[model samples]
Target chain A: EAGVAQSPRYKIIEKRQSVAFWCNPISGHATLYWYQQILGQGPKLLIQFQNNGVVDDSQLPKDRFSAERLKGVDSTLKIQPAKLEDSAVYLCASSYLAGGPNEQYFGPGTRLTVT
Target chain B: GESVGLHLPTLSVQEGDNSIINCAYSNSASDYFIWYKQESGKGPQFIIDIRSNMDKRQGQRVTVLLNKTVKHLSLQIAATQPGDSAVYFCAENPHDDKIIFGKGTRLHILP
Candidate 1:
């Protein structure tokens, strides 16, 4: 079985520029998630999608960040006017279920470097 | 504001010895706990998990212990190898809620 897939394993953008990351979840997975991992810190949940609907995005900065899952399969996360603090790895994960001790399989992640 | 956190930032264990990593969570409502191993430049890989109803769960030389009284979680690796060197993360989730991850503990296997 193939795992979660993400694009542009690495990205670099100037401050105030916009950047986007793409993700394709595992086949038949019902839940998808996006997380940000800063240096020396654990990955923080940014948003979660159960099928085509959002399950949670309370931690996401709405002023700069946004994400969407289309057709309950592919998802995209975007950051506008990126700040230096936005330099971190963006990870995408997918699970077979929406809840209950589900094992989420993660992708390699897209490393974003905002200069 | 409740979050999961590791007891230590880094732990160095001699190869072939047993390794233990500790974590503490603030949310009592969290019922499911999971441990993930993150290698350099790679995303977190699931190690094992234990439910609130379970005090201990073992899988392939790895064990997870959950102490509900203190809200503490621990991961134990037997006969640690160099391949086991990586950051270990503990995550918690309430029933049908989002999973929250802890800072992580970097495990260094020493020769």
Candidate 2:
């Protein structure tokens, strides 16, 4: 079984620039999540999607951050006019669609650095 | 505003010894708790999990203990090896849906 996959394991950009990260979740998993992990901190949930529908995105910076799960299998998170404070590891995870305790499988995150 | 937090920021243990990482959670409504291990350059890896109804659950070389009364949780690793060195985080799902993660505890194995 393949785990969640992410692209561009690392990225560096100047302040005010734009950056995006891609994620491919495990097959048959209906729940996909994106998280941001700052140095020395645990991953923070940025957004969650359940079968192409936004489940929760309360922590997402609406002014600068946006994400989409078009076909429900893959997702992309974008940050426009990125700021230095946005430097963090963007992680993606997936889990089965049950209601009970769902064990999430994470992908190798994309480390973003804004200069 | 943190629903979960680690008691220790970092812990160093001698290899082959057991290691216990502690965590305190605040949400009494939380029904499920989980522990995750993360390496330096990777995302968090699921270690062990225990539901609110269970006091303890064991895996191959790991165990998760949950104390609902005190809202406390702990992860135990037996015969810790070098490969076990990483940051461990504890998360909880209040409604069995969304999860909140705690600031991790760095576990260092001294060979």
Candidate 3:
């Protein structure tokens, strides 16, 4: 089976510029997640969606970062007026279920660099 | 504020030897734990997982051991190969349904 898919494996933008990343989760998976992984650090959960509705986004920076899972199959994460601190790899993952010990399959991720 | 952290930032082991990565979590309410392997330029890949009720779980050449009393979790890779060299992260599922991740340990395979 195919795993989660992400677009634009790498991106570069100037500070204060806007950038967006896209994710296509595995088929039939109910839970989709977006995470930001800084260099030498683990991925931090940015937002989670169960189908078309959001499940959690407490860590998301409301002032600049936003995400949406419109059809429940694909999602997009956007950062407006990106900053140098926002330089990190953005990962997308999917799981069969939301809660419990279900395993998650991750995409290749998009590496964003802000100049 | 519950958090997960690793005991060591980096570990080096000779090829063909076993490797063990340790992690400590502060949330006693966490019910599930998972180990993930992440290579350079790639996202984390699930290696093994264990539930709160179970102390251990094994898959292929990897094993996950959980100690609820100490709030510790470990991943053991037997007969490690060069391909096993990667950053390993421990994650926990708490009551809030969030999967919190540790900073991760970089495993280096020495030839």
Candidate 4:
């Protein structure tokens, strides 16, 4: 079976510029997640989507970050007016909710370098 | 604001030796615990997971031990290989609730 897929394995943008990352989850997966992983730190969940509806986004910075799970299959995460601190890897994950919450499968991730 | 943390930032072990990585979680409500392996320039890969109801779970050569009383989680790798060199992360979750990840522990294998 294919795993979670993410686009633009690497990205670089100037400070204040806008950048976006795309993700396509595994087939038949019901839950999708976006996470940000800074150097030397674990990935932090930026948002979660159950189908097309958001399950959690409390950690999302609404002022500069936005994400959408269009039709609940493909998802996009955008960062506007990016800051230097935004330089990190953006990871996408998905899981099937069979029986109960299952282990998440992650994509290669998009490395965002804000100069 | 993450409440989970690793006991050590790094661990170096000789190849073929056993390695143990430790994590401490503060949320008692978390019902599920997981361990992930992340290599350079890649996302975290799921290793193994254990539920709160179970104290131990084994997968391949990896074993996860969960202690509810102290909220401690540990991952034991037997006969570690060079490919096992990577950052290990522990995470906790309570179903739909927020999942918290620990800082991470970098495992280095000495040749």
The numbered model that scores best in TM-score is: 2
Write one digit per residue (lDDT tens) for candidate 2, span B59-84: 99998999888999999999999999
Clashing residue pairs in candidate 2 are: none
CAPRI band of model 3? medium
lDDT of 2 at A97: 76
CA lDDT of every candidate:
0.94, 0.93, 0.93, 0.91
Better of 3 and 4 by lDDT: 3
lDDT of 4 by residue, B1-111 (tens): 338999999999999999999999988878999899999988899899999999999999999999999989999999999999999999998556456788999999999
Judge candidate 1 against the unseen true structure and give its global Cα lDDT, from 0 to 1. 0.94
True-structure RMSD for candidate 1: 1.1
Off by over 4 Å in 3: none
User: Candidate 3: interface RMSD in Å?
Assistant: 1.6
lDDT score for residue A43 of model 1: 90
lDDT of 3 by residue, B1-111 (tens): 989999999999999999999999999989988899999878899888888999998899998999999999999999999999999999998865578899999999999
lDDT of 3 by residue, A18-93 (tens): 9999999999999999999999888999999999998888899989999999998999999998999999999999
Candidate 1 segments whose C-alpha is farther than 4 A from its true place: none
> Which is superior by DockQ, 1 or 3?
1
* lDDT (Cα, tens digit) per residue for candidate 1, span B58-92: 99999999999999999999999999999999999
lDDT of model 4 at position A85:
99
